[model samples]
Target: MLGNQKVVQAFAHEADAQEKFEDINEDLRVWSLKATFFSSITNPATRFVNSLVYASVGIAGAFAAVKGLLSVGQLSSFLSYANQYTKPFNEISGVITELQNALASAARVFELIDEEPEVPEKPDAAVLSNAKGEVSLEHVYFSYNPETALIEDMNLKVRQGQRVAIVGPTGCGKSTVINLLMRFYDVDSGSIQVDGTDVRHMTRQSLRTSYGMVLQETWLKSGTIRENIAYGRPDAAEEEIILAAKEAHAHGFIRRMPEGYDTIISEDGGNLSQGQKQLLCIARVMLCLPPMLILDEATSSIDTRTEIKIQKAFGKMMEGRTSFIVAHRLSTIKEADVILVMRDGHIIEQGTHDSLISQNGFYAQLYNSQFAV
Candidate 1:
């Protein structure tokens, strides 16, 4: 909530957020009070019991001493034993809050551990070795909820090394096409295939390894710059890593850092700007040099000049390799070999950019809408 304060303010939901925060704060306050009451109760009660025991022992010991029935040393020894007996209870009470927190965290961990994998790979699944990058989806049907349909009867085919661009309005299932191809979600019916072999028949690891993906939302682990770039192929040489960064136009900023490639990145690259993080993610893909590429608005965070440079780099990287580009900006996909314009989970039109624009259809209108006078 603190991180996205600007978003809350921008949407004019300050009061709504404040209400939520106050509710959470109230719950926390109640929990803390209960915990403090319980924890605080144990120690004082034990202390009072100890004091009473000491007082009784002292009085009895003094009486006994006066009658020469007990010695001073004997009373002192009994008092020491009492103190030792009560020490552990005090220690345990002090740690009650910590123990509660640990148990709560453990419960959450166990819950995650018990979750079943949605797309489990078969034990005898074939390895997709040296994929030729010929992909096809036939009569695909899928929906997150069974009652509501998303992608219905979708069909697509691409030969080796073809650049296919998917363009559509918001929520038109452009990203769903990428998800199906990647097998992130299994289709309800029909099969998605690569090189004439169904993806379900292949090992998920082998199938995913065939494509290098870069999403609009970049992900980077807490590691040095070099480690993130070489995440896919950890054995990548330093020179190869540098070359990839250079190609992605990330080297300049990376070199300017305090420790260059050795500088540690905060969790999820929090220390870096969004554009810089995207560039690093692109460099990671470049280093991997997979047989296929899936770019979903990969350059959206980048400036126009930087995007142009990255596009040229992408052009080189995509040479003779099958690539799927999911983009919102029509201008960026003008050079695509085939553009698939989707609407409501169906491909309404598929053709080259010039051909689609010449038709003056939905794609043309979308393109013109961006630059309308």
Candidate 2:
């Protein structure tokens, strides 16, 4: 773990260094190109001046030699030596300038290649065999920065196939809890265990493969509608893609498109409505069929009518799966098995919706403030 932290710090430092080097190198190249052009013009002028001097000397010598005042061999030798000397100097000067510029470019390119990855997976870490989705956080502590704790001494657990909702004000560490569970960032102290196995001991790829996520922002690559839905399982049969889309209530809009399943989606799915995009994201997650699902503000951006439709789709998707829903809309998660109210890196209250409402504590206040709307 110490080695891993060192590697992460080193990689971050290298990335910063590379960015600075590239910026400086780009400025150097531009200046070098202009310098080369000017040097080309200046070098010729210097050679021309040398040639004129040589020519004047040759003419004077030839005239004197013809009058028996100088020698033909001596004049020929002087002209030959001057041409030989200036030619090499002009070529070498240009070569040196060009070499400096090329060196700077090469340095920037190699620096980036030399950088290590920010997060490195262990070579022989165990692959999760059958994750039961039983997660536990024991006295967990975490912070994206050293001075402030995002989650501190927080303890929680969920049984297999449990549906939990985390609701709180923005920046109260609701997402941080999900990030910790996903192992996106390691805890500063304590342990996060999944199915009795410490999450840190599992390979990142296998750990993440156990859970599926649908974010508020639906990121769709430029591709056919069928391709986006089948993103999680590219080899899924055509019928499977159609089934998942239908479950998400996205089939109607997709069918109306000119090409149906084959319709091309613009980059980031810019052609689709916000609700349609969210539905597609849900469809993609459904195709993966992970044991655990994470919905991070999954319905925040859509219209109320569309939100209800997507929420229904989420209900169907969460059946029999261990699900974690992070949202600000309390009504959307009223049916969750457990609700956690967080504030300033701590879980201030947790229970079923009815229980928390009866307590009239932090959770009750939050619900009354927002759900009353």
lDDT for each candidate structure: 0.92, 0.86
lDDT of 1 by residue, 1-373 (tens): 7899889989999999999999999999999898888877876787787788878988888899889998889888987897888788777767777888899999999999999967777888999988989999999999889988999998889999999999999899988889888988889999999999999999988989999999998999998999999999999999999999999999999999999999999876978999999999999999998999999999999999999999999999999899999888778888889999999999999999999999999999999999899
TM-score, one value per model:
0.76, 0.78
lDDT of 2 by residue, 1-373 (tens): 2335566576776676667779999999999899777757766767777788788988888898899877889878877887887787667665665777689999999999899765676777778856789989999999999987678899988899889999888999988888999998899999999888888888988889999998887899899999999988999998899989987778988999999999898886768988789889888997888989999998787777877877887888788888999988888999999999989889999999999999999989988988575
Assess candidate 2 and give its lDDT.
0.86
| Weakest lDDT window of 10 consecutive positions for candidate 1 | 89-98
Q: Among all windows of ten consecutive residues in candidate 2, which has the lowest summed lDDT?
A: 1-10
